[model samples]
Target: MAAQQSQGIQTLLEAEKEAAKIVQQARQYRVQKLKDARSEASKEIEEYKKAKEQEFKAFEASHAGTTSTTQAALDKETDAKLKEIEALFQSKKKDVVNTLLQRATQVQPELNRNLKKLQA
Candidate 1:
């Protein structure tokens, strides 16, 4: 009877050791899985960032041509307005000078009349 009791105690100790080993293995597997998940997530994020950067470069390349075309159109419009202003000034130049001369004569009539008589 004493030998049987000793064998039972030994069996219990063995079972306890087996349970501890299984628990330790489970913890190690969980840690390894977590590390693998983090590494995969980091890789996915880097790939997504690179893809977005490439998309932005493509957009910039496409818009560059439109920007130059728009700038050229604006330059042409500015040149047309400048030419129109020059033409308007040329057409009114003679009238503006005649008005100035009349105002000057009115301001000093005696000196202007004497100068006109001398010229005649």
Candidate 2:
């Protein structure tokens, strides 16, 4: 009976060791899974960033010609407006200068009414 009791105790100890090993294995598996998840998440984030950058580049490329054309149209419009303004100024310059000269040279002299009243 004593021998049987020692055998049972030894079996229990072996079962406990097995359970401990299983627990350790479970913990290691969980840690490895977490690491894999983190790496996969990083890879997904990098892919998303690359995709966005590609989209941005595509958008810029698509609009590049339109942007230059728009700029050229605006420059042409601005140049036309400047030419119109210069023509208008040239047409009106002689008239404006003549009017100013006439106004400056044609001042009329008048007697003061107050001086006449004082003298009377």
How well does each candidate superpose onto the true structure, as a TM-score?
Answer: 0.61, 0.68
Q: What are the clashing pairs of model 1?
A: none
Model 2 clash pairs? none
Which stretches of model 2 miss by more than 4 angstroms?
1-12, 99-120
Task: Please provide, for model 1 over 1-120, each residue's C-alpha lDDT reduced to its tens digit, 9 standing for 90 to 100.
Answer: 999999999999999999999999999999999999999999999999999999999999999999999999999999999999999999999999999999988874355777889999
Worst 10-residue lDDT window, candidate 2: 109-118
Ten-residue region with minimum lDDT total, candidate 1? 105-114
lDDT of 2 by residue, 60-99 (tens): 9999999999999999999999999999999999999999
Shift of residue 104 alpha carbon in model 1, Å: 19
TM-score of 2: 0.68
What number of clashing residue pairs does each candidate have, in the order they appear? 0, 0
